[model samples]
Target: MSEGVTLDRTGGLITLGAADTLWADLMADSAVPTASAALTSFPAHARMGYVLLGDRVVATVKTGSSQWSVLEIEVRQAAAELNAVEMDRQDLVRIGPFRSAAKQEPMEGTALRWRQRITRALQERGGLERAAREDARPYHLAGIDWRRILVEQTRDRTVRTWWLPRAAVRVLDAAEHTETQWLHAARACQASAVVTEPSSHHQQVPALGSRPTTSPDCPTAPLRPYNGELQGHLYSVLSRKPGTSRRVAGWACAVCRTTPATVLDHCHEHGYVRAPVCQSCNTQERPDHLYSNDIRVADHYRRLFDTHAADWLRHWHRCPGCRARTTLPLPHLAAWTAHIACRSLRPTHRDARSSRARKPCGVLRVSWTGSHSAPRSCLLTVAVDFCPSGEHRVLAQVPYREAAEQFRSWLAETAPAVAAAAGPDRLDDLPTRPRPVIADTSSDGLALF
Candidate 1:
């Protein structure tokens, strides 16, 4: 009981162990006394980290409020014990035996811009003096070993802080070589999730008793043959012994977890297959230096709305005030009128670069294509007196004039001002048929006039 242990929480019970010593942390928050004083007096926090075996670290997160369900008890070796070499140049004072692996000359137009960015970076780190002195050093054929360096790389505002050991990584090069130490060290940090056990857990957890850097043997299935442009290079780097198609496909797309992986997405700057991605995610374009796969995330939302428009429309109810089918719930006349007016007030645009869609008449109104008869049309059509954006439902055709009268009376009673302005004239002015135009037809059964 004196030694600390790693812990995993399932529902109300906490499973505390690493090397097999079980303990528990329960949830009772009334200041009651218990046998284990430590558990009773545990501080209220979302996450807890503990040290075990002097150099190993374990962590858990609270997943529930009432029961304090701590989850994903993971153990990691302390970075210090690896005799990790610090590679940051901020502390260095001399040019001794350190240089970039490859020559990178800025193009004609970018020379000044590149120099300015470099200067700003150097100034921030207080390394301008060291850099100036290093420029005087004679060119040498020797290159620094990237394996021993500890560097911080930044992409998409998320700073990746890690140590790169050469033997544990592999990256391909322009010359079709998979032994480039610099490229491997640069991109190996993004490897796809390799460990899957304990069905509920979705993260990559290292196998118990295995070194943190060592990945388990690839699956037994035969490797898939490559037929792409980089056949030789891809096979050499990706088809290595510990790599397998089953293993890659077993992992979800790194950008969007909902899709199974089909493409090995890598950093083009350095040939490292960071993770497996879906076709949509791998092909999407993004701005330079922003590598967080925001394009894939955007596409996810786009497809969600585009594919499930009908499903979403089901949740909306007709507004009594404007009879528009909006995201707002029904019977709330004031709110519905306000929502329509606000949407219609927004400026419209045709520019592809605009973030917001141009809604010429912010209202979302639907039309009745069931009948051309006045009474029947008024009862069934929602987009007739308003913009076409409001049509979001399928209605059964009705010949009853009472239904039309009831809707008109409800609209006038709910919003007197709007009804007074768009009164009988609007209803009487309803178009019998939509104009013969390209925008008249949509798969959703809603058309814009």
Candidate 2:
């Protein structure tokens, strides 16, 4: 363990690892000796690097008491300390990186107003400086990587706006690509999982796209760019596999893990073909930049992207979180950042939400007409409120309300009648409702006979 790993209860510097709970730290019995002396000092501080919600600076809260993080702590004290540093977190507006694979322009007009407002608000108390990370080794390109020019204005009293691109990141060697380097990391992940046999794992591998400068392999070379024709490109990539490069096999969205991979998601940073993503993931994952809130998170993302993403199927299905988050759609950097930070305040949030449930105010039986060949059956839900919504909205979020119980019970009672009457709709509404019902002659449900 390094000297910096020491935890002094008196000094009140409580740095909890992703796995470490402050509760455990405080509740631990006094001065009991253990086999592993190092664990008492450094309790697993590092975690897998991930694509975090935002470019966040850790706001360390200090109190004389080590138990300051406990739920029972006085809100006034926690708020006072946290507000001094993190209250302005929401108001901190970002500037620049105004370019893409397409446009390369500095923040101007509407984008220009924010910095001026921040500077104006600062007055004489503080000034701004363009801080550079000593360790950021930018990839050599023909022109300035305009997309990399991201500046986030800090909300502290001094109000510092930093153009910190890849600052303080112990990234891979400049010559090596993330994909090429991920093999080892994948092995580490597999090894940790204690798999007796080798099986691929990629729950959250990034669906990055490719650049001309990026390495063209069996996996990457066939994958089309985001701007290209999707279905046609998918066909080309699938059909045109050479002896050197295996066909890019998986056809599922990288993020959602369920939808047919519609678009080729590229790494915003390296311009490498990361993975295939559905239109939904492509539409929502707005930030071209792959975000990492902490070193561990970033490292995990790199390793995952480099390894699992190369195998599209394993990447999409391995981790359950990636599959689940698709519907909930933690979506992008902004949402994930807010979500993790807000978790600490869940005790308070729970208390605040103890009011009456927002149950269905009223229910409607709006009929939806669709073709017989329509692919979805989740549309015909019994408990629905008037949202002027369609099948997608219902499938996505709108849940069964508390007030829907009575109607649902009645509907359940009527299920036998509904099944009996399912034979033919007497053309009361639709012109095609009276169509003849085909007999299922086969004993098996497949109707092949």
Best model number under TM-score: 2
Candidate 1 Cα outliers beyond 4 Å, as residue runs: 1-3, 6-449
- Which structure among the candidates has the greatest lDDT? 1
Tens-place lDDT per residue, model 1, 1-449, is 22444343342224333222221122122111111222212121113222121112222323344332222223122222222322223221111111231233433321112122332344444453444465443111011122123234433664322222211111100011111211232245336444555544322333444432111222222223322322113323675646465455545445445344555644232222345544434433111111111011122222222343222222111111121211111111112222232233433445455756543432323222332222233332222123344433222232224443444465455544434544323334333432221121111110000
Error of 1 at 396 (Å): 24
Provide C-alpha RMSD values for all models, in order: 28.1, 25.8
- How does model 2 fare in lDDT? 0.26
Q: How close is candidate 1 to the true structure, as a TM-score?
A: 0.17
